[model samples]
Every structure is written in structure tokens, then in C-alpha cells.
Target chain A: MSDDNQHQETFEDFKNSFNYGSRSDLNFKFLKNLSGEDASHFFQELLWKIGDSFNDGDFTRVVDHVNETQAKAYAGVGRFTYDDSPFTPLRAPLSQLRLGLMTSSGHFVAGDDPKPFGVENMSQQEAETRIDDFLKVEPQLSVIPMDTSIEKLRVRHGGYDVRASMADPNVNFPISRLAELQAEGRIGELASDAYSFVGAASQLRLLNHTGPEWVRMFQEKKIDALLLVPV
Target chain B: MEAGGIPTVVIGVHAFRDRLAAMRLPRTVITPHPMGRTLGAPKDDETQKQVILAALDLLETAQKPGKIIDLPGRYRL
Candidate 1:
């Protein structure tokens, strides 16, 4: 099917799931206000909101205040698929496995090598202006090894508040905490390096291409287990 | 790449736990926190360590793949 039809079907499915039992006119009217891309982003955020409330069993209440007929629409698109590599279990004990940290928070330290996003050196205003450009920077086509220490680390992500992470990089990356774990013998060893990149980009090409490539890089470290921290 | 012989686990907020489970990557631990502060509030070493330990524990105790364990606490910005 063409992209237009697929988007229409997606909107229809979202309307059915979200506004069930509501008036058809109201549902279609709300959907009609949205462009195809907006419809997709709405569905994505709506799903995240739903996922947050899944444990409460109060999902019906969550949607009750959506104001179906009067909601404004914006433009953006996102999609997710379930296709993934097969599952692999941790065969070795924690004390015997090597661990690594990978984050989407886009961390770097001063005096380190330059990164793709270039936001680390940009002024706040410049970074904000160039946010979309950073998303296009798929450094190394996957994950890039971060050469940073706790004292030198700085947070450069544009998608979320970076204050917490800047004050203490462990807020997002948790490298210091992980090292403490290693010292305590809670884990065997820490990888010589960690990985980071700005992840709020809406690019599926980077997501799909990075998975296998990330695995290849981590494998070189003989990393027995990995901790994926997504923002 | 869990299927490629390296076991992996994800740490994210409750908002993305379902998709993480659906992704079927491996084990996942959801915390009731914001996106950037996945481990917990900054400077809270004890709580942060606990969160990491909980997720790492799931790496071993999860009976099946795609299991999501909720860390016991709330950290709201």
C-alpha cells in the first residue's frame, strides 16, 4: 500500500483504540485536524502515556480527559517494529562477566576527541538552533566509544534537561556507579571504554543500522553483558 | 545484540517499559523516573546504586526473556 493509505489506516487504528465509544464525528474530526505525520507522533506519545499507566488499571481514566474534539494537532512522525535478534542469556556468573555502559544521553568530557553532534562546544542558543542538524550526525554509523572521565564529562543532549547530568554525569551514564560495582566485586570487570550519542533523533535508519554494529564493537571488548541506558 | 552471545538489559522509565518488553531484547528494569535520569536523581548514590543493582540482578534472575522488573521507588523531577 502507498504511504498515504498506510498513514490513514494507522490513524483509523489509533482512533479506534484511543477514542473507543466516543462519537464517530468527534473522532474523525480530531484525526482530520492532524497531518499524517502528526497523527503518527500522537499515537506514539499516546502509547507511551498508556504504557506509563498500564500498572494502574486506570487507563480509561487517563483518556477521559483527552478532550477528543478540541485537541490541537502538530507535525512529527515515529514508528517502531518488533523485529529483533534472538535472545541470549547471560551464561557466566556476574563475577566473571565483563560489563559495559551505552547511553543515548550524548556525554563527553573536556579535551576529548570531537564528536559528531558538535553540541558540546556550541553555545546554548547555537545548540538549540542546530538541534535538527545533530540528529543527522550518525557518528560511526553506530555507537562511538566515549573517551571520558568523571571530572571531564559534560552532557550535550538537546532533547532533555541536561542540568542533572552535567552536575553529575552518573545521573544518566552511571559510569562512576558502575565502577564502584566493579570494585565491590558485584561484577567482574568494566570495559575500558563506554558509548554515548544523542538519541532523541527521529531517525529509524540510525536505530536499525546501529544495533548490529554496536554488537560488533562491544564484541571486540569481549563484553559479556551490556547495560543499555535509553533517554 | 543478545542473540549474538552478549546478554543485554535495558534501563528506562515506566513510560517505555512495554515497548522494551515488546522489543524482546532481553531483560528490562523500569524506574518511575524521567528520561535523562534513568538511574535516579543526581547525587543520590545509594538510590542510584540500588537501581543499577536491581537491573543487573534481573540479568540473572529473569526466568525468561523480555522480563521487566520495576525498581522499588519513585524519582520525579
Candidate 2:
């Protein structure tokens, strides 16, 4: 069939397609917006796509299109950091901070440290008052382009050194130089501002909670770019 | 990084995209496998660029302040 004669299937064409990638922790409402009949039809087609991975090219094209959209639309993006912190007692690292706040208040960044809100150094009255005020950053973290010579974007999945359950993504030399790039101020040149750990395949529980929070937090922060590097 | 923010693009699998769309979050799908593996080939800049560019398309044509677009099909490199 010609492209025009062929019907274009939408996400709604499926009953329960995989919601397992970026924001896997969402309260899904894909079919809720449509009537029961339409929802049924959506699922019908989705099942067809699943049974036959026949449209790989079409899917790839769409993926390419979305990639372009992300670049042109946002001010900047960053990878959700997944490294095991050198700092001991860093509970969940960046994902923890970002997800905890979102799951808790649905408003705070995933990386916002709530520890200061729970400090015993303050009085009860002071502590209670500081709870809300503490979230707002004094001097918010900002992304500035690194003035170093650059050819391409490279990053390690920062978490490989931390989590045992994860794989060693073992990126090339370019990706491995993330720290050097950051130090040289070259990381801020592209759309994504930071490099995220792309190596954790075993932290599904944490990812299910934290990854979504990162996406939500980035949106709230008005971050336009996102990068994930597997170790 | 300590780097300043830039209009970013993330290439993700369709599953992740659907989840985001369901939750009303905004992001683009690269229709690949799970996270971490962008182009399937490790550190292959050529494949990675193709994948990255796919994610960039969403940023380019996103009309409204908030929108979630289902990318066309699966991605292979």
C-alpha cells in the first residue's frame, strides 16, 4: 500500500503497549481519554504491531524525527546522573533526589536534597518553616558551555563504578572523558547539559521510580536536552 | 555536569515514550530497546549520531510549550 493509502497507527491503537522506557512510572491514562470502542480499536492495532516487528524502518524514522524535535525545541538538556557517589551515605544519588521529591510533592526536582529540611540543628519552629523554603536553591545549578576543543559528545554511564548489578557500558575514549570534558567546560556546548549514567540495567526498581522523576524534574526545570550514557 | 543547561534531546524506546505520554510528561521516543543502549552498537559515533538526531526531531517541531509526540516507528542502526 502507498504511504497515504496506509493508515497511520497511533499510540492509542494498542491496549497496553510497552510503557517501559523513559517515564515508566507514570499513572497511565492513554486510553482514558478515548471512548471504550476507540480504546478497543487502539489495542487491536497495537497487538498487530507487536506480533510483527515488520515496521522497523517506520519506527526508526519516527525515532529520528523525535530526536530532531528534542534538539530544536529545548534550551538545554542533561543526563540523569547515575554514578555511585564518592560521598558516603548518598542514599539514591541524583535519581534518588529527583524522584523522591517528585513522588513526594510532585513539584520538587528529583535531585533536590531534602536533608537540610530534616536537620536537627534547627529548632522545631525553624525546621517546620524551612521545609518548604529549603527546596528553592540559593544559586541554582546552571549549564555553561565548556570552552575546550570539541568534535563530538561522549560520556560514561557514571554508575558502572557504583552498582554491581549494572553492566560496564565501557564507552569509547570520548565517552570516558566525561569528567575531563566537564572540568574543561566543554560539556555545556550541546543541548544536554550533563551526562547521565547509562550503565544500570539491574536497578529497575530505582529506575522505575527515579527515571520518571528525572524526566518530570527536567521538564519542570525547563531543561530542553537529555543524554544517557550506558557504562 | 557543572555545565549550563541547553535545549536537550534524549533518544528513548517506544515503551518509555508511551509511559511518558500516558503520564502526561513530555519527551521523544527513539523506538529502541530499553535505556542505556542508544544505537545498539557500543560507542559507535556514527550510529549514536543517527539515534541522537532522531531524538532531536521532537525538539525541532514541538509546536506548543508542552507536547508528547509518538515517534513514527522503531529505530535500528
Give a tens-digit lDDT track for model 1, residues B1-77.
77668888889765456556566656888876655677887898887899899988988777567677877655632
Model 2 TM-score on a 0 to 1 scale: 0.31
Give the Cα error of residue A13 in candidate 2, in Å. Answer: 34
Worst 10 residues of 1 chain B by lDDT: B13-22
For A139-229, candidate 2 gives per-residue lDDT tens digits of: 1121222222233322212111111111222221123233333344433332233323222223443446544555565666554344432
* Candidate whose lDDT is highest: 1
Per-residue accuracy of model 1 over A1-231 as CA lDDT, tens digit each = 568755654545655443212323322334555656766666677787688789776664334323221223312222554654467878877888888888888776565534445434665344444567766766432233443467777666655667778888887799889888999999998887888877756466566776677788788879888898987
Runs in model 2 lying further than 4 Å from the true structure: A1-188, A191-193, A197-231, B1-8, B65-77
Best by TM-score: 1
lDDT of 2 by residue, B1-77 (tens): 10222233334444345333443223334444323343443444554444444544554444432344444433344
Q: Which 10 consecutive residues of model 1 chain A have the lowest summed lDDT? A: A69-78
Q: What shift in Å separates residue B66 of candidate 2 from its native position after superposition?
A: 5.3
Between which residue pairs do clashes occur in model 1?
none
Q: Count the backbone clashes (under 3 Å) in each candidate.
A: 0, 66
Span of ten consecutive residues with least summed lDDT in model 2 chain A: A99-108
